[model samples]
Target: MTLRIGVIGTGAIGRDHIRRITNDLTGGEIVAVTDVNAESAKNVVSELHLNAKIYENGHDVIKADDVDAIIVTSWGPTHEEFVLASIAAGKPVFCEKPLATTAEGCKRIVDAEVAHGKQLVQVGFMRRFDKSYRQLKKIFDEGKVGEALVVHCAHRNPTAPGFSGDMAITDSFVHEIDVLRWLLDDDYVSCQVILPRNTRFAENGLQDPHMILLETKKGIRIDTEVFVNCKYGYDIQCQIVGETGIANLPEPQSVLMRSEAKLSTEIYVDWKDRFIDSYDVELQEWIDSTVKGEMNGPSAWDGYVVAVTSDACVEAKHSGGIVAIELPERPAFYDQGNNKVL
Candidate 1:
């Protein structure tokens, strides 16, 4: 049976998901879509020439009985509402990162799913699907990287979005928080944000860069380098250091074919270049899982942990001090191989 998919928010990622479902690869078909920018939504529907229905709002799309699953790429604040509505409608939903803008918001979505007594929401943290990151995990799990000691994660973008600092913590670094927790299979106990010397490359009044230090429940430490304006390239890197060995994601190596006098490979200037395949793999899994009545990606628990940690990061950034991240005790529900962090 082909799963009927509904996509909300016709922005870049939203349109990309629609394209993925309609053209590239799919276990489902996009049956409906919505966006606050109705003009863009109409444009997408017309551009794709897909007969999918267009709705004025996400609520209408999710409530439509035909929607078997939902892909939520809307603004961060609206995620909680649509996700909870989908849960109420008993439809599986794939929400982009930060599940919600606040920890309280995330909790509401989590509680809704818990009340439903099943997993119905999958949060987007695409790093888990990246081949290089998965290879690093495999090597770490093989004990090639002995007793994991520390992990250094970096997320740098070539430019900053025209949003607030809250966005920096929520929409952006939230991915770092979630993926790090998943990689180490540990919960964060606290977080501290350190502001570096301001970079002239950033826009006026923009924070430009910061460092997030996180400590896990099991004492594994993680340092995340977050810079929105590196003036170099779009980059994501992680190095896992263990008592016995070290493993890290190698940069994209290319065959340097002789051309003009310049010996060069390729540098991704944007995320659409660097993580496009990862996004595709992530969405494909989501579609396949929706068809099978199962999910393998990050769970609501993962989203909750990230929300809790990101909240703490925001506080740390505001208070100019380290803040404790209090997480509920780990539930046995995630203890299965699905979350076996090395």
Candidate 2:
């Protein structure tokens, strides 16, 4: 059965998902869409040659009977409302990162889902579906890593035009927050942010390169360097050091060139190019599981935990000290054993 989908938000990521669902994926069809920018949304409908109707607002699209499930890719601050509406409508929703902008908002969605008595939300954290990351996780699970100890990570971007202020932590580093927790299968105990000298290319007073330190409950240490204006290329690296061995994320395959006494390979310029396959796999899994009345990726609870951790990181970034992360007990309703990390 093809699931009729309603997509909210027609921004870059949203439009990309529509293209994936319509062209690259199966078992789903985008029948309706809405975005804050009406003109842009209309243009997308025409540009993509989609036979979807444009709703005046997101709520209208959710209420439409033609939409079986909803996908929320709207602004971060508006996620909570649309997700809650989908729940109230008794439809499964796939929400992009950040279940909400605040921990309290996330908790509300959690409470509503728990009250409704089912799993109806999937948060988008595509790294869990990346093949390289999955391989590293499998090695750790198979005891090849032998009790993981430390992880060194780097997230670099070629350029960020409007990135500034706390967005460095909230917008970009948040992915690491979620993926690292899943990688270690442990919750964070405390977080600290170290801001080094700013890059001259940074705009709007944004801190160019920042280091985040996270300590898991089991004493696993993880450090991530976020460089938004590195001016090189989009690169993500992670190396895990364990007791007896180590594992690292494999680089993207590229044709090696040797010329003029130099050997070089191409690096991705944007995240969409870097993690495109992961996004496809993530969405496919979400659709397949939702059809079976199940959710297979990061849950609303994971989203909430990440939000709490992000808040701590932001606090640490501002105060120049360590901030402790306090999370609530995991409820039985969301428990699915060892698969929780995925």
Instruction: Write one digit per residue (lDDT tens) for candidate 1, span 299-332.
Output: 8778887888887888898899889988776565
Per-model root-mean-square deviation over C-alphas: 1.9, 1.2
Name the candidate that leads on TM-score. 2
What C-alpha lDDT does candidate 2 achieve relative to the native structure? 0.91
Model 2: which ten-residue window has the lowest total lDDT?
333-342
The lDDT values for all models are: 0.83, 0.91
Error in Å for residue 236 of model 2: 0.5
Which residue pairs clash within candidate 2?
none
Cα TM-score per model: 0.94, 0.98
Candidate 2's clash total is: 0
- TM-score, candidate number 2: 0.98
Task: State how far residue 315 of model 1 sits from its true place (Å).
Answer: 1.2
